[model samples]
Target: MPPTPPSTPARDEARIRDRGDACPGALRLHAADDGGLARLRLPAGRLTAHQVEALAVAAETLGDGRISLTSRGNAELRGLAEECGAELAALLAEAGLLPSPTHERVRNIVASPAAGLDGLGGPEVQLWARELDALLCAEPWAAALSGRFLFVLDDGRADVAGLGGDVTLVAVRPGAGQEPAARQESAAGQDPTAGRLHVGGRAWLVAGADAPRAALAAAGAFLDAARAAGNGAWRVRELPEGSTPDVAGALDRAGIAAEPVPPAESLLVHAPPLAPGPLGTASFHVLAPLGRLTAAQLRALLPAEEVRLTPWRGAVVVGAAPGHQDHARLAALDSHGLITRPDSPWAGVSACTGRPGCAKSRADVRADAAPGSARGLPVHYSGCERRCGHPHGTWVDVVATADGAYLVDGAPTPRTALPDAVTTARTGAIARAATPSTPAETTR
Candidate 1:
C-alpha cells in the first residue's frame, strides 16, 4: 500500500461558495458541446427491468444512442436535441423512471451494488430502500434539495455509505447491541439498542424509529436545516457555520431510533467480467467499451434482461439466462473495446470530449490521452479547468492547461512534455517543473 500521506492542511475547503449546484437532471438539462445532456438519477442505483428497457428506448429515440453512467450511480443521456427534452421527460415518466417531477432531482440515492447478490442483505435493505424512497417522494418540501445531495442506505457493510453520502441508513444485525428506541437519553453511552446511523462519518442515535423511518426523518431534518441556512447549499455537509443537521437530534425530533457510531469502511463492488445472467432476465447490467455504446449494439440489448445502471461505469443486466450467449455478448462488447477487467486501462481512465465537442476546451485532450496514452492508472483527460467526468476513487489526474498539463498523484507534478510525460507516469517516474503556461510546455 502507498504510505499513508501526512494529513494535509485544508486549503480548498473554504474556497467553495454556497450556490445551488448546477447538477443537470432529466427535467433540467445542460447544454454541452455534443448537444443537450440529461442526467437520470436512479435512487439506490436500482432500476426495474422495465425501467432499463425504457432507458434504452429513451436513449435511442430522444438522444444519442449512447448512455453514460455517472459516479453518483445515475444515468446520463447525451447529445439530446432541445425539442426532445419534454418528450423524453414524458417517456421517462411513463416508464416509472420518474415518479415525481417535482422531487426528481432530489432523489439521489445509492445503495450497495451487491445488496442482494449471494444473499447479503436482500429483503431488509430492499424494503428499507423502498420505504425511504416513498418517504422522500411524499415530502413536498424535499423538492428544495439540490440535485447533488446524496442519500445512502447501506446494509451495515458500508458499500454505499463510504461514497460520501450526506444522510445514511445502515442496517446492522438484529442481535447486535442497539440503542434504546427512545429520545431524551444522555448522549454518553453507545445506545446498545439502536445500531449506528452515521452522517458525514459521525454516528448518531435514532431513539424511537426503525431503520426505514429513521432514515427518512434524518433526510428530512437535513433538508430543514439546509434550507434554514439560507445560503443555497444543497448538501448537509455544505451548510456553513456547521449548520448541518444533527443526526441524533433529528432522529429525536422525528421520534425515530438511532445512536452515534464510528464510520464503517465501505467496500467497492468490483465484479470482474462475467457471463451474462440467464436469458429473459428482467434487469441486466451491460458493460460498454469506453462507456460508449453504439446504436446497433444498444438495439441488440433491447428486450434485455432488466438493467441496473452501476456507478462503476458499467451496466448490470439482471434476470438474464445463465448461458444466454455470454461469450458472444461480451465478445461483441470487447470488439468495441469495452473490456470488463479491472486490469484494463480503460477500467479506471475517463475522458471528457475535448476540442471539437466542447467549445471551452483549449486542446484535443481526449485525442492525446487515448487508450494508448493510458498507463495502467486512473488518468482523466480534461480540456480545461472544469474537469468534467473525473473518476471518484483514488486516481492519477492528468489535467491539461494552455501551456502544458498538470499531473496530480498523491503529490503534484508538472509535465511539459505531454506524451513523454504520460510514459514517465506509467513508469512511476516523478517529473517536476514550475507549472507551465502552454499545453506543449506542460508535456514531458
Candidate 2:
C-alpha cells in the first residue's frame, strides 16, 4: 500500500459538534458559496424516472442546470435562484420526492444499490429500507433525529457497513436448506432471520422475521439513547462511548425477541468498495466522474423507471423491463462520458469542486486531478486542508498545498511527481486490510 498516509482524519471517533446539524433539505436550502443549495434525501437512494426527470427540470429551470450527486446517495441542486423555494417545493412534492416535510431530512437512508437487482441482499432488503423509511416518517418523535443521523441497510455486504451509520441493518444468509421470511423471526421456510441489526460497532440478531421492523427498532433504540443522553446527540456513536442502546431490549419492548445473531467480530468483515461498471446481467452502474451530474446526463438514465444511487458517487441503473438488455443504453451512457468500466483510469479518482464554486478552495482540484489507475486505493484531490469528501477506508490522500505542491499523505511533493508517487503507494507489493478499531463497525 502506498506508505499508509501519515495523517487520515480520525474515522472511528464520535464527532463532537457544538452546533446543530445544518444539513439542508428540500424545504430548507443552504446558501452555498455557489448559490442556494438544496439537498433532497432519497430513502435508500431509490428514485423513479419521473422523479429523475422532475429533478432535471428543476435543475434546468430553477438551479444550475446541473444536479450534484452527494456522497450520501442524495441529490443536490446548486446555483438555485434565491426565490425558487416555493416553485422548487411544488415541483418536488408533485414528483413524490417530498412525502413528509417534517421528516424529510431525517430520511437519510442508503442501501445497497445492487441489492435486490443483483441478489446481493435480495428484494426484501430494499423493501425493508422503504418500510423503515415510512416508519421513520410516521413517528413524531423521530423528528428529533438530526439531519446527519444515518441509517444503512446493507445487503450483508461490507460495502456500506462501515459508512458510519448510527444504525445499520446487515442482511444475513439463512441456514442451509432454509428459506427466509419477511416480518417474522426465523420462521420455517423463511429467509435468514431478516439478517442482523447492528448499532454503532455492536451487533445483535434481529427479532421479527421482518428485517424492516428490526431496522426500525434499532433506530428507535438510538432515538431513546440520544434522548437519554440529552446532549442533542445525532448519532448512536456520539452517545458517550458506553451508552449504545440495548438493541435487544429495544426489540423486546417492541415485542420482537432480541435474538443474538452473531458477535461484533463476525459482522466486521469489510467488502471491497464496488467500483463503477456493469452490475449483474442487466444492471449498468456508473460513477458520476466526480459526483457531479448535469441535467442532461441525469435524464439519460431514464431508459428505466428507476435507478439506485450509491454512497460511493456511483449509481445502479435498475428497473429495466425483463429481457431488456441495456447494451444500447449503456453505450449511450458511455458516449455521454459516464464511467462504466471497472478498469477505466477513472475508477477510484475523485475531486472536490474547487476554485470558483468554493471560495474556501485554493485550487481547481478537479482540473488538476490526473487520470488514475485502479492499482491503489481510492485517491481524492482536495483544494485545501479541510479535505471535504474523502474516502472512508484505506485510501490515498492528495491535498493541494498553497505552494502549488500537493501534500501526498502529509509529505509535501511536487505536483509533477504525484502520479508516480501515488502509483507506487497504491501498487506496493504488500497489501493489508484495516482491522476494525473497536469491533465497532463504523469508519462512517
TM-score of each: 0.76, 0.88
Highest TM-score, which number? 2
lDDT of 1 by residue, 65-142 (tens): 877767666878888898897799889999898889888888887765555543544435655666677888898877
What's the C-alpha lDDT at position 391 in model 2? 66
TM-score of 2: 0.88
For model 1 the local lDDT of residue 256 reads 59
Runs with alpha carbons beyond 4 Å of true place in candidate 1: 1-19, 119-123, 174-195, 205-209, 262-286, 298-305, 323-329, 371-377, 404-444
Q: What is the lDDT, from 0 to 100, of the residue 128 in candidate 2?
A: 79
